[model samples]
Target: MRLQLNSSSHTPLYLQLEAALRERLASGEWRSGQALPPERELAQQLGVSRITLRRALERLEDEGLLIRRQGSGTYVSQRVEQTLTALTGFSQDMAARGLRASSRWLQRGIFRATPEEALAFGLSPTAEVSRLERLRLTEDEPMALELAALPVRYLPDPQAVGDSLYAYLDLHGLRPVRALQRLRAVAALPRVAELLAIRPGDPVLYIERLSYLPDGSVLEFTRSHYRGDRYDFVAELKGGK
Candidate 1:
């Protein structure tokens, strides 16, 4: 549907256009990551000058509702702000924000631990480990690619896991009480970009996490690649006493 600008209102044309576009996003008329019509085409459709439409688009971009790629045009941003202070599962986080969380499994099973996985899990090279690899989704949109490894004793049946690995661990009394995480910015590789629906070389957040059980045993070693455009990691700081 074409968005109509209200000329009779006291509001500025650009502001009116911005509000209408925001409504379209809020109402799901424009889905997350969906490209917007070309500037000229959209301006014509809205019966507004290019300048007015540009101004409105700029406003939305500033507010993190739109992303403007140099050669790819504008797309609706699927921005989800996550707090760094929380030790929560993906499903729990999405539930807090009233978004449905789901997963598309890429790999799941017990396998002999690779050298790196063996070192991470403190297991022998021949020891088996349960691996769960999946694409995390929120509101049916792909959000992150996660690969997690744990000792087979803790996760004996990878197929028993569901939407949330943390939840599954909790039920088995193996959930982590604390975690150490390292996050870095990396360019997406072709395979990751394909699964994430972004172009290769786009920025992505790479995270490595080591979650510990209450007794300080490592419970999980997880590596994740999150779409940079979709996630904002917020950290809170307070002054020392």
Candidate 2:
């Protein structure tokens, strides 16, 4: 990396280093997940002290632009951003990013509703519900594991459901107009980690959604686990007038 730093300028050396490194990152000098040069080598090449280089790298790590592993060198992060303001399906979200979305169906069939599903869909506990479990992928990369349930009245034939559940619901005039969603961070369990190709203890985002139709009937209840390292959820806030 050829970075020019001005020692005579008023800007501190660490900040200057940070800016230069960020520029290189933005310019794609180093691809995502590529390791940075050793700290000592990088400092010598930049003609700056290792302390200054470390400070700059620390800032980048804290900002989620770089990740530092104990035995491994610093590497670019591969995090994708998702805005929380929109209500969209996995297929739509991936399409907006110009990525092909696909799914590997895990399970699909009609089953008796659980107590929680019964309450969410206003159905009796004994009522059958269409359940679908899938591993969702973007550009062939595992992105999320999803489990969704809908009252049998809405989705009677689970086998007919395709990659996008919302699309299927829309075709039947049962698409949800809005939804209530909650998200929390949790460690990945062994099975989930294996499917997502992450370490068992790695953090993952757990999301629960309850979607409702215009007539106020619950459309679907879904639980999803998203790989934390590859996904970042953002929410926009408005200031008081």
Candidate 3:
């Protein structure tokens, strides 16, 4: 790719470089998963210092537009966009995009509610809850790690849960009518990094949700860690026109 740097411009070299690279990606000059040119060669070709080039690249990596493997080279990232206005399960979201969603159950059993869970679900201190943790995937690619809890009254048989938790609930007429969700960005801890296949300290989307039945009874409490490089969440706001 031919990139021109305006030495006469007041913009910092790194920022200019970042903008140019971003434009290239936006224009489809480099497709997802395509390896970028080596640092040394590209630095020399652009007549910019290695530090400047690396800074620009690092910014992109942080924004989830690129991935840099330790020994392997850097490549463009493949990401998915999710809308925040809908209350949907991982399987349903993936299906809407024509992608297959699957999960690997990590833990499932009935357990006494923790202090936090008890408060969030409005259960008694000694109340029992069914907890389920799984690694959610799309097209076999690791996407998010989910930990969900429900009142034992609703999900008595943890073993009966399958690929889609919502489907399981629907069959038993326990499907929730609405949900409240909160999302924030967090640095992945070591174990979370291992499960998501990203380096520790990498950015991830941490989401917590509470679902409610039509009668306003709390139905589910779910916490999810989504891969920052592979996902984007969008929200639409309306103002007086």
| lDDT of each residue in 69-180, candidate 1, tens digit only | 8998998987788998878888998899888889999999998998988998888879999999999998777789999999998988999998888888888777688899
lDDT of 3 by residue, 176-220 (tens): 999999999999999999999888999999999999999999999
- Name the top lDDT candidate: 3
Q: How many pairs in model 3 have backbone atoms within 3 A of each other, for residues 3 or more apart or on separate chains, i.e. clashes?
A: 0
Most accurate candidate by TM-score: 3
Check candidate 3 and list the clashing pairs.
none
TM-score of each: 0.75, 0.74, 0.79
Pairs that collide, model 1: none
| Worst window of 10 by summed lDDT in candidate 1 | 1-10
Candidate 2: which stretches are off by over 4 Å? 2-78
Position 114, candidate 2: lDDT: 89
- How far is 230's C-alpha from truth in model 2 (Å)? 0.7
1 versus 3: better lDDT goes to: 3
For 139-222, candidate 2 gives per-residue lDDT tens digits of 666888999998888888999988888889888888788899999999999999998867788889999999988989888899
